[model samples]
Target chain A: MDSTIIIEKSVIIVAVFALTMLMAMYSTWAERKVAAWLQDRVGPNRAGPFGLFQPLADGLKLFSKEEFEPNTPNRFLFFVGPAIAMSTALMTSAVIPWGDRLHLFGRDILLQATDLNIGLLYFFGVVSVGVYGIMIGGWASNNKFSLIGAVRAASQMVSYEIAMGLSIIALLMMTGTLSLREISMQQAGMNWNIFYQPLSFIIFLICAFAEANRTPFDLAECETELIGGYHTEYSSMKMGFYLFAEYANMFISSTILAVLFFGGYNYPGMSWAVENWGVNIANVLGFGALFIKLCGFIFFFMWVRWTIPRFRYDQLMHLGWRILIPLAIVNIIITGTVILRADIAAYFGF
Target chain B: MSTVLIIFCVLAAITLATAFLTIFSRNPIHSAIYLVICFFSIAGHYLLLNAQFLAIVHVIVYSGAIMILFLFTIMLMNLNEEREVHRPRITRVGAIVSFCLICLVLIAIFINSKPIVGEYVTTGEDYQSIKVLGKILLNEYMVPFEFVSILLLVAMIGTVLLSKKEKLQK
Candidate 1:
């Protein structure tokens, strides 16, 4: 029985890993396609039909490119930077529940890599360490531009994270659980948290944008101003790793947003479908539903990237600290009041 | 049980080695990185105890926020070449003496605190989950919680005041 469980878990882990990579790979393609369509230009169409093989081609190019490095003293840290970035991006997928469960071989198989009790916090922890990648890479390069970019990335993340965490606290108070799976299950049958906590959702979305270093919040790599920002000194696959990590981070952030707010894997009439079609098919559909949600969120990310202009550094900080933090705190207070309304009403004889 | 013990030993080794490296590393940035690894190793120990919430929070607060800020400061100061060259040999001897004294003190504390006849018992995992931790914190530790918030408020005010530039009177 234990061995069977182990096998099932191993299979799920491989599947999740492959799926994350696949999504991230396509996200790069989709990003370019979206950008092209947005600007009234054809994008990467020369590399296989509709640029489907563009990422593969890009990968080969990056691999074949010269492994360039700045004449810096800290070569170890330079190499370690992308490794930290890639690993942290991948680590977040461990706690996220991809779907409900599968009933295979007469036993229930969990879709998550691991159902960590404090999954949300685990996600935040991984995200926090993600800063090290950019910082270490930039600093090790010993380039002024790289250093400035790393500093910007560090401060911007620090600011946005405060607001992000505060907003999540409000949601946590409402849900009363830290487990992502529990949060996902709570949003079953259209009782999405976004409906009740729209303010928090907006805060989270903005923070997600910032956290993933997406547009408007992508001051870290503002091309014209910083000349590739933190990665000005990096080249070849090391540079590719940083860029790939960003997309991976985006994928994970979208998945988190989907799970946290958008009724993850919970479509309308899902319970009915399960009753009629049995557990396996129902779960299969649920997984599909989650994929659909993830795609929608990924597309949203791309759409915003092309549409919105990047924020000035000071403006980003002001939004994160001056506006979002206060708003998130207010949200928490309001949520707390609503939660205790019954008790308050009882006391006041309402 | 043996597997858990082995894991614990590995984590302990990592934590101790990283902690030592954190202090002894020549580069300030390398020291900061070592500190982060040390923090992660400690977090691993927390996980073994099934205090998952504490483990992740430790990672977030220590490796995430604190370490990032530390790294930022180190970079901003350009402290890569921070090794002291003009320090007198006497000061180095004094530093070594102090370090040995602290080590001796820590060993004394460890030896004194260990119970003679009691086997360490597991706290059985239920207590450290976020929900229970929250309940206990809000109910029993409410005063300290409020106090901490006030302390943070004061610190924030102090930071703003300190960082803000004042206009000079003509």
Candidate 2:
């Protein structure tokens, strides 16, 4: 209701939007750079200042190019495809907490866009809807390769999501909260969840890779198999939207991985910084810390992508249903037993 | 208040309409997709309920995982535009008559029953959490919890038996 509060909320929203877009943009550049480095070649060095403007150049290219559509029956669904991709990609950021509240101009500015009690669930819901975009795009394209790509994507995301959800159960049991902010707050300083639930973290990390359709798990649209996968029929900005969504998902999932299992903006000396420097400066550092952590996860994504080969379809299924799901169930059981130890202890009288 | 009510009405319509379309669609694949729309509208309802967790889980389980399975079945079966089977006129008539009869009976029961409005009781708490759900499932609903494992085992065996290929005759 207050003017300052409104301004601060607007500022935070704008900042997060800017940050997500910027990250998605740079992800394109980073992918190119990493790909070039992996292949031992010079990646885009001709743009503004060591290819810093490469994303801009790429954006311009997408815009300037002729947008073509196949002579398909369903043009409406075709158009809807990329819109779904872009929107679903943007929507998942709603529940993520960017940082602790910033005390500015005598008002507390929450760093999150929205704090639904079930923020984690909301993230999963939005992220799961992301597959529909690809499925619709591929099916609507009326191309076999595109259809195959869509099927692969549908199967892959659905398969991996189970493991991802199960892996989170361990942390949820430990933290006893579904709110992303609460999860972050629980991880004060060195009490980051990775120390307690390393296996769950690893399972989640792998599942995140799978869910994002990154390497090894990226059997959905491997170039050798599906020829540009689901977006084979798309061109120009439409194609760009699909790729942009992928990179944006990568960034968001990495941010989540950092926040959930890693200490999420909580550095060792964060409280010290808050006490000595101030909330704004400390939170600035916290934001920086989160970014660094996020970058590490992104690099890890690219690193695994370049290092490993794609799994065979059967192997992918085996990993998802047989391996990851079972592992996740075990992790949940272990977490549950650990959490209810007092009750168990009382029952045993030991 | 009117705006919120209007929005709720539109969403509820979309939800129920899509759900009807899901079951009514002749093509199984179309049914799967309409089911997705139905899930989305339910998530909207969950947003209204302030049960963000259930909404997300609903999407994750039903829209994400379960629908994917349905889609996979459709794809694996290759249910193209041509393969749809049309039921006989009598079967169709029977279905329609039964559906209408059921609806009428439900409406009649509702109209005939005495109105029982009780005191408005607010939960006023975060009880629908994964943590709380787990506790309740393990403690109070342990019998049902254990029964699910047996049910899954029977289903698995049934599927294996049903899907077993016939022996070759030399």
Candidate 3:
């Protein structure tokens, strides 16, 4: 690669890293704020105006807290746990196309870190590996509750990942490309996949929740049962890392949901805006559109968290294995049939 | 000397060291973790070879899914207290014989295989991309692919049957 391309990519990577961190930080504040609002209370107004700096305050508190470690022999693995969680949480944003290309400095700049051809699979790989962080952390803690929580998380994530992958296969059949940029480009001007593949979208959305270990499916950390779940033995910045990773995961999954089902950076009048306005302005608007969709999904995630009760362990398993997986498979079959309808009609001489 | 060569060497060293650590580690969990690293390094090798799809799938299947299950099983077993296993002399001799025989066979195979004479040549073909890979697997390797699926299905059915039978006994 040329020096300019390298520089561009590094800048994009740093920007995305910062953006993910910002979103994750705000998501913490937003989760509490939204939860409080739903429950009819003032939430964190003491920090900055409207408690915007609450996350920062929380970070500082975590930093100042004493780093507590359980008397576990596997100290290295215990340390590796949060590091893995934090890194994997941040890694998923690499392939996401934040917006359409921008015309800057007389060069067309693609607003993504890297456009891997198998971007969807890359996302899956990173997400699947995310289980290790929890499993290792929980097991290393040498606590029965932590171990149970980790096991629950592992089974839950694994079961839902199947459904998630199947649901995306349906979308892939329509888009015929694994590149997020191409997927986003295909969804230009109100042609979102959600319109056509609504079933897949719903399946993917639910699986996204399960995968992120968000509420309703968050049996891993359901305070009533598991007592803080995998991070039961964690404290100080270590516990903070797990919490931050969860919010980061929620943010990434929300972004993925928007990018896959919703039109990503595309809006209803995107074509008109592109035709009338310049590419930079249009792309900036597209980025704003994507941001709105992702934030809306994030809010929806929190909304469901406070509203819906956590699923019973068996109920969670039943929903994933019996309901979602089969539904996702059926969605794939239906999508395939719809996509090849003309060919099938010709074959049947209809 | 070259950057690519340096990266390959680093990955190779990681792969070998992790593989050895996987075997030599006292704790089963540590072994599993090392094995996960070994799998990841192999995936890195695949990426180095420009087989991006293969690399990611390798990571997903082996390092991600399989290793998670392995760790789960190990953790559940709670094998923290190491126990010494006493193998009979004949069994130990047999194990050593088999290990050496397998190593000899692998070495012979490598020695017999044709060696590359020059720098690796790029065919400049779209062979490793997911689209082409899917086309090739469905078209040319259709029978083997279907057979593999059937094998997996059979295994799944066998597992379900075993578990169901145990439940019925209870």
Q: Candidate 1: list runs displaced more than 4 Å.
A: A346-350, B80-125, B165-170
**lDDT by candidate, in order shown:** 0.89, 0.84, 0.92
Query: Per-residue lDDT of A9-92 in model 1, one digit per residue for the tens?
Result: 898888888888888888999999989999999988988989899999999999999998789999999999999998888889
The model with the greater TM-score, 2 or 3, is 3
Q: Candidate 3 clashing pairs?
A: none
Rank order by TM-score, top first? Answer: 3, 1, 2
Candidate maximizing TM-score: 3
- List each candidate's DockQ score: 0.81, 0.60, 0.85
Model 1, B45-113: lDDT tens digits are: 988977788888898998889888988888787653555557789999999999999999999978864
Q: List the residue pairs that clash in candidate 2.
A: none
Worst 10 residues of 2 chain B by lDDT: B114-123
Model 1 DockQ vs. reference: 0.81
Q: Candidate 2 chain A: minimum summed lDDT over ten consecutive residues — where?
A: A4-13
Q: Comparing 1 and 3 by DockQ, which wins?
A: 3
Candidate 3 C-alpha lDDT tens digits along A1-350: 78999999999999999999999999999999999999999999999899999999999999999999999998998999999999999999999999989999999999999999999999999999999999999999989999999999998998899899998998998899999989999998788989999999899999999999988999999898889999999999999999999999999999999998898999988888888997889889999999999999999999999999888999999999999999998988898887799678989999
Q: After superposition, how far is residue B47 of candidate 2 from its true place, in Å?
A: 2.4
